[model samples]
Each structure stands twice: as C-alpha cells, then as structure tokens.
Target: KSAVSRVLSGKPTTTPKKKPGSPSKLDERTKRRIVRYMQANIGVTAPSVVASLQLGVSPQTLRRFLNAEGASYASLKTSPPLSDAHKASRVRFAKYHLDNHTDFSTTEWFQGQGVTTTEWPSLSPDLNPIENIWAYLVKQVYGPDKPNITCKAQLRSRLWHAWETMPKAVIGNCVGSMTRRLTQ
Candidate 1:
C-alpha cells in the first residue's frame, strides 16, 4: 500500500532502529581507569599510557579517543592582560599552592643571590627550528592516537626518527635566509 494509504489506515510510518555492529573495545572499568589516571597525572603521556595501562591498543588509537573525549591540548589564540584584581588573586593562589606544597629551595637560592624575578612581556620561543622537534613530540605524546607504545624509550626512538627524517633543505633554507632577513 502507498504511504498515504498506510497513514489513512493508522499504521506506524517509521521502521525500528538497527542495533550497533559491535560493543566498544574499552569496557567501563577500563574507561574509568584511563580517566582516573589522566586526572591523577595531569601531564600523562601516550607512551606512558600504553606502558603503564597495557591497554593493548596503539598510541594513535588512544589519541583519537582522547581527542573525541575533548582531552586534547588547545592551541593558544588570544589572552587579555591581567587586571590588578586578577594579579592579587594569582598572588594568593601562588601562596597557597607554592608555599604549602612546592619545594622551592631553588627559588629561595635565586632570591638569596638577589636574582629577583621581574614581569616580562609574553614570549613564544617556538620560532626556533629546534622548537619544531618539541612541537612534533607534543603532538605524539599529548595528542594520543596510538595505543601499543611500550615505554618512554619508544618516545626517544620516535625523537630520533623525527631528527633523522627531516629534510635537509628545510634547515638549510632557514639558515641561508637568516642573513638576508636580518639585512632587511
């Protein structure tokens, strides 16, 4: 019968939804463990995740999952200057977090040597070519796409891979253009 006839007959118009193809790879317990570990260690890395948790997945897979969970690090876009009230709140926060919890003997030593800290304009030192290495690694570590990474040693190996794999012309061009850029 036509759909108009079915409507006139008062039959249901829609079909039932299909079941999912399969269950998720990670069960509830595993999901909770991952979330707890990340919370406990604010700076958890991908290599560490695979090594410590033995999740049997690749680092790339974990990274994609974490990104889906909205746990990926964000790139900075803009920030306003702090007002005096904000500065005072920051001072209070430093006092609570630092004096109470931090071992700042190094800070004290600097103070004793009269190496006083001063406010400076913001700087993004990522312009240096070497900084590219760190940016690449950060994407691998914090970006969390893989799952089988065994240890920090894997991270070190990847570092060497990056260093070895970069094209020569990129570095050569940077160096070669420096003089011309400075002359301008």
Candidate 2:
C-alpha cells in the first residue's frame, strides 16, 4: 500500500484546524439575539426573524453563526420538565384529544419519548424544572412585549435580536435542568 494509504489504515487523528479567512461572519451578539427571540416566543419563525434583523444576512449566515458557536436553534427551544400544572394541562389535553379522536390513546401518548405519566410528582411543583424555566424565560424574553410590541415585523425583529443575544449560560442552565430531572 502507498504510505498515505498505510497511514489511513489505522491511526489516531488530530483535530483539524479551522480554515483561515473563512467568512468572518456573525458575531456572538447576533447569535444570542436569535436564541433570545426563540425563547421570547417559545418558538421562532425563520423568515420573520431574518427580515427583522435587516442585517441583510441569509438564514445560511445565521445558521453558520450558530454552528460556529457549537450550538443550534433547536438546542434553544428544547422541552423543559413538566411541572404539575403543565403536566396536568398536558394530560388533560391528551385525554380530551383521546376522547374526541378514536385513533388516539392516552397511554401511548404518555409513554412516548421524553414523557412518562408515572413520573408525575404530586405536591412537589419544584420537581418540574420546566415550570421554573418558563418563569425565568418569560421575564427575560417576553418582558418587553408587555409594554408594547408595535407590529408583527417589529416584534419579529425584536425577538430575533433578543434570541441572537441570549446568553449561552441561560440556555445551558435550562437544558441542564433536564439532566438533574432524569437522574433523579
């Protein structure tokens, strides 16, 4: 085999270096804003966000920006723990849907991925981290919406900017709560 071929046959590889002069793209400020926006709405609409920023950047640019930060938009809007109220709401909704729809079943829905009705805690609302997170996010993400959100475009823009600027720590903290929940 050629020397290059022999080396490839079995060897540990070193981490590759980032190519120099790659697009000196979006900065941390913009990345957080996107995350904040997503948090504000508990969801995000891509085109609306793009227009709001008016940064003349493409979704690809925003995506690349996230990728560079080792995070993605999906990571920001993960499902938080189900508090009693939230769980009860979910169960009620599921039950109503089940009764209304012959094809649906509560057991199946409850047992689906990341869901477990058996784990529902009583008299311990704190056990549900998602509840706490919603409270926190509502304050930071949606606090501005109360005074006034002029228009859809403006709202969209503001959310995008907020999401782009949201701190990784905040996202990390909320997501991390899931870990503690699962472990217990």
Question: lDDT tens digits, residues 147-177, model 2?
Answer: 6767798677766766677677876787787
* Candidate 2 residue-pair clash tally: 18
* Superposed model 2: Cα runs more than 4 Å off: 1-106, 109-117, 126-137, 141-147, 177-184
After superposition, candidate 1 runs with Cα above 4 Å error: 1-22, 74-184
TM-score of 1: 0.31
Best by lDDT: 1
What tens digits encode model 1's per-residue C-alpha lDDT throughout 5-32? 9999987898898887766677778878
Alpha carbon lDDT at 120, candidate 1? 33
Cα displacement (angstroms), candidate 1, residue 177, comes to: 38
**TM-score for each candidate, following the candidate numbering:** 0.31, 0.29
Cα misplacement distance, residue 36 of candidate 1 (Å): 0.5
In model 2, the Cα lDDT at residue 73 comes to: 55
Where's the lowest-lDDT run of ten residues in candidate 2?
A: 116-125
